[model samples]
Target: MSFNPFSLAGRRILVTGASSGIGRQIAISCADMGAAVVITGRDPTRLDDTLGQLVGDGHTAVPADLLETGAIDRVVAASGALNGVVLAAGIAKMVPFRMISQAHLDTVLGLNVHVPLLLIKSLLAKRSLQQGASIVFVGAVASEVGPVATAVYSASKAALLGAARTLALEVAKHKMRANVLSPGYVRTPLLDALGNTGAKIDALLDITPLGMGEPVDVAHAAVFLLSDASRWVTRSLFIADGGLTTRMSV
Candidate 1:
């Protein structure tokens, strides 16, 4: 019995933030599942590195600053029609309430919220989305669980969840699906930037009963959401945080 429900053969997927971390993993995973993927990031070198790692044919690298909202339409035009999109590009910053400024809010929200929303609008406007298209937004457990000095980041993520829900409803008539993949502390460059502040790492681990998650852990979930296997699964938030949110009080 050959089970091929997860096969993405003939599908064209565009993955943002594909240069590194979870986005990189998702691009590789999607390619492995037989999708022709377009990997996008600001770093051309890193995007090329990811493109090289893709397992199958038709994978391409597209370097674009997603922060440039106007460029989103060009990105869609370059990639052609998209069957799926993984909006994985984002930034995380830790700033206390007193230290938070308009710049901080704009940077965080621009990347996390504004970019994804505008990208979707551009993609839809191009009429490039095929029926049954899936759009997966990478969210964070921080949206629901509180962490010190992550108010801005958390708010941005929370906004994604809300936006995805509404977008799901609006796009359903077009036979397109939208959802959020929220992950906990996965081993990524963002986490590495946090550094080992003595007990901070240990404290986080203690709260997460299943320990730290790897990039592939979230990547696999992304694959499921992108593939036809999850055709009925839209307007939902799939939490892949290894039970971290369940253990935490926030």
Candidate 2:
């Protein structure tokens, strides 16, 4: 047996949202660990950039929008068989509950929740996922602890935790595992887009014991969940917060 259980050699993994941010980092880390990664994103140029950052060969870039129903099957067909799948794509809207419109709700839930669920189902049905494959879904700390202006976003993320738990039970028979990676306010483009700047952002960091986190922080956790090191770990949530959740008041 190899001494390094974290090595992903001989494994083929699929990573969604790999054009940038946490997803991009996950793809890079997977390749560094010796996995042949298939990365997907809506941007062909950014996907090519991620592909360029990978350390090894056999890394493929599939440019597709995961929000489209038609894209799900296409992603499955392009990925073929895989030892791991990481659902790192998500959307968030931080607005007061009363102001949230139907379109807003749909956009948030559609990309964050519905797309991953359907994509997972498509991959499983197509046998695109090999037995004993690891599945990691990116969740948010807001799911467990509520934050102002994120009611719908919180709901969408919480839904993933519930689904992942049930999925773990259903897929255990096939030696496959399902888990969630919940990250706190990381310095990603998504955060910036959500208006997590100025004093509001400073306030968040003030409460966090370990301060701000980088994309690599989450990528390290994703690698653990994907590697054989976590073969016994499943149906669980691995939180990579910088102590923000711990310092939250009730």
Candidate 3:
């Protein structure tokens, strides 16, 4: 008997932060796997660009900023029931600890931590997540690496890791799964925005044996977590960092 556990046919998924970068790639990859994808982002134009790139039909674009209190509710309400949910929307900045401000902390934590948590809450309230559905929270290697100038970013991602683990236990009764996907350095606009120039990337290559990863690299790992292939997987943090952690640990 032939079997392919990764097929997402007939699955309906909601992917947040799908306007660009990792989230955009994840949305495209999920659609490639035959899932009906609903992608959300604050920029309607970028979301439309992503929606246009998706392979299959029945995909939707809902523009909403997760930082807003009621925005998530509207997203879930429009999505209907979902077989998977990928919380890939996040904010990152390289600000020195000495320069960290209250506003900075609030903005980082609000979007990275509170938004995803509240979004999940909204989904649950609306019964938008089907039984056996999978949840994927996109964390970052900064949480584990403790890099310089990423105090709040690391904390926010660490909070997500902790929350996803707890959510896994709490949602067991619903036959749902939750996990975190932590990636090292990926080539995205966000990375460029973080001031990672070619020189910086060359420096990073020294520590990361496989060099910088692509958005699709992280997206593939997310696909596994969101697909039936990971039916028995939950409360796990899947690191797709191309051996950065391994090298750093040595």
Query: Compared with the true structure, what per-residue lDDT tens digits does model 2 show for residues 5-81?
Result: 99999999999999999999999999999999999999999999999999988988999998876888888888978
Q: Per-candidate TM vs. native?
A: 0.96, 0.96, 0.96
lDDT of 2 at 37: 97
- Model 1 RMSD in Å is 1.6
Q: How close is candidate 1 to the true structure, as a TM-score?
A: 0.96
Model 1: worst 10 consecutive residues (lDDT sum) = 194-203
State the displacement of the C-alpha of residue 175, model 1, in Å, after optimal TM-score superposition: 1.7
Task: Please list the residue runs of candidate 2 whose C-alpha ends up more than 4 Å from where it truly belongs after superposition.
Answer: 196-199
Q: In terms of TM-score, how similar is model 3 to the real structure?
A: 0.96
lDDT of 3: 0.91
Q: Which scores higher on lDDT, 1 or 3?
A: 3
The residue ranges of model 3 lying beyond 4 angstroms of the native Cα positions read 196-199
Q: Is candidate 1 or candidate 3 better by TM-score?
A: 3
Give me the displacement of residue 168 in model 3, in angstroms.
Answer: 0.3
Whole-model Cα lDDT of every candidate shown, in order: 0.89, 0.91, 0.91
